[model samples]
Target chain A: MVLSERDNHLIAEIQDGLPLSSRPYREIGRRLGLSELQVIERISALQDGGVIKRMGIVVRHHELGYTANAMVVWDVPDDQVDSVGEKLGSQPCVTLCYQRPRKLPEWPYNLFCMIHGRERERVLEHIDSIVASQGLEQLPRKILFSGKRFKQRGAKYR
Target chain B: MDDTDRAIINRLQESFPITDRPYLQAARELGIEEDELIRRLQSMLESKLLSRFGPMYHAERLGGGLSLCAMRVPQHEFERVNEQVNVFPEVAHNYARDHEFNMWFVLATETPERIGSVIREIEQLTGCRVYNMPKEEEFFVGLKLEV
Candidate 1:
């Protein structure tokens, strides 16, 4: 869906966050020269259109002692990736899971699942459980533990 | 964080209502006073427990672009490459991961074409080959971390 000028402005406003107030919409409406109802309806429209993926609390796993995060990638056969991906993604412990193209020779892994935990051993165990439960024990895979966050911020949508 | 806070975190992770009196409505559902809910939410944001609280956009859905680009600069030139790559505002975040392709960062651009242009610019500026890995399929994306 193409975003109107006002929609863009509205997105720019709430993307950071809705004001922490009793009537947050009213405040946002006030800033954008839109009524509270307009703001609510527009946001609903965006959500329906899939422009806004989700609206809620964004948890910081690192702050919550889930520092031992690992990106587990698997080189599953193309034919079985969809089923395997869904299986991996259905697990509660798996935070983010997606399929990306494999850059042959150097990066052979295609399916990626992000698992986070307070302990490194626990994260590994979770992966082990997923592999065993999903019947993916023999797949070629690699665990990439993220280190040193040099930059982090909300996406710039303007 | 106590039980109430934990409960609030878990509840809110599912969703925050979009309504006139959203806080009141949400607090009612969560079985907490609206004022208390607001206070806890504020406190969490301030304490950095919740990095952010709002709409997470889908760039592709918005007619833009998003991609996870990886690179392998020599150990000696990693920092310099990082600086050059990050100079572009399109680079949302960069992470040093344990792999041959060490420097991994996500690019969120205003247009789909910008992704390639930015990749070209980075390759030219840093002289390091960037492995552009856009998602072929998104199996799932639910970032609900129960505190």
Candidate 2:
């Protein structure tokens, strides 16, 4: 859906985040010369169109003591990836789960999942449990811990 | 963080009411005054516990292209390559991971076709092969870091 110029402007204005206020939409409307209802309607439409995934708080997991973060990659057979990925993604320990193209001759892992915990051993144990329970222990896997967080933020649209 | 703060973080992470007075609505549900909820949220945000509080847009669904790209740069050339790669506006979240494929970054472009060109540009600038690993399938895990 092609967004209007006004819609783009509204998105750009609130992309960073909404202001902490009782009536945030109303406050935004005041700034953009829109009615509170109009702002709500526009946002609702955007969400309905799948543009906005959800309006909520983005928590910093590290601050919550989830210091050990690792991106676990697995070389699951292409045929079994869908079922295995769904099962893996359903687990609470696995945060982000997806299938990316495996670069042959170098990168062999296609299925990827992220796990975070208070300690490295704990996170590894969680991964081990998932692999064992899901019958994915046979597959080749690797876990890469995030070393330095250079940047972590929502994709900038503007 | 106290019980109320924990409750706020847990509740707000899953859902934030979209209404005329959202904070008021949420506060009523949380059994706290609207002002208190707002104050607590403000404090959490100021503390950087909450990176942001707003709509989370799916860039791909919104006619934008997104990909998880990685590169393996030599230790000495890591910083220079990182700077060169991050100089592009399309580069979103870049991180240094302890692995052979060390440098990872999320690339977001206006068009799906633009993804390839950006990767090419980055490769030319950094003189490093850019592995454009776009996600083929995504499973919704209801990812929520419950504190």
Candidate 3:
């Protein structure tokens, strides 16, 4: 989609994510020489057109007492993937669920989901429940947790 | 771009202040009715074009452990492996990148040590090497899509 100069300017400003101020739109409008209403209208349009997915908070799971986090990989059958993935994605604990191409002699997973909890055991327990609920007891699976947080940010729309 | 869309995006890009009745504050600044501002926001969110409307936190400040991980799974077993990797709660985002390590994902943990253990568990269970390609240098690519 073609973007006007003003649209470009506005996208650039909020690319790093919204400003954490009560009058964020006003602040942005002030910098861009636009009114707050104008700013809001532009964002609404962008969102409507699928250019901006959604604006939401990226919670710090650790701070929220979700200490144990892990990437659980599942070896789902090709035919059963769509059904299984849909079911998995519906779970609140499974924050992210998507399919990815696997590398031969390297990677071997197609379906993936994310689970979190305050304790490692609790996280594992949740995983167990997911596996059982999904009838994946016989599936080959693995979990990869985080060792360090190097970087994290909302998608930049510049 | 039409005037209406331009106006909405322009507003979304700004940082909303953290205060009581922030929406009202925004409305006053916009010279529009508070209800109108809220209705617009609600409609945008309902449309699924916008994922969410809220705060974006600096995870590191809260002592969270995060890393980018990759695994090499045979194409024949791609479906199986993908399902296994995604089950973990720590895996925030997973992608099918084009490379020798086709499957890549990001993991965030409350403790750093758990990150290592999680990787180890995946390796043992999957019978594949979990190459931990942790971030050594940070590159901030602020790419915001302008619809």
**Local distance difference test, each candidate:** 0.90, 0.89, 0.62
DockQ of 3: 0.07
Choose the strongest candidate by TM-score: 1
**Model 1 lDDT tens row, A68-126:** 88989999999989998999899998888889999998888899988988998988988
The pairs that clash in candidate 1 are none
The digit string of per-residue lDDT tens for model 3 on A32-118 reads: 999888887887666655455345433445544555767777777778777777777777677667665454445577777667766
Candidate 1 to truth, TM: 0.96
Give the total clashing residue pairs for model 3.
83
Interface RMSDs of the predictions, in order, are: 1.1, 1.3, 12.8
Give the winner by TM-score: 1 or 3: 1
Q: What share of the reference contacts is kept in model 3?
A: 0.07
Per-candidate DockQ vs. reference: 0.83, 0.78, 0.07
Error of 3 at A75 (Å): 1.4
TM-score of chain A of 3: 0.85
Measured against the true chain A, the candidates' chain A TM-scores are 0.96, 0.94, 0.85
Off by over 4 Å in 2: none
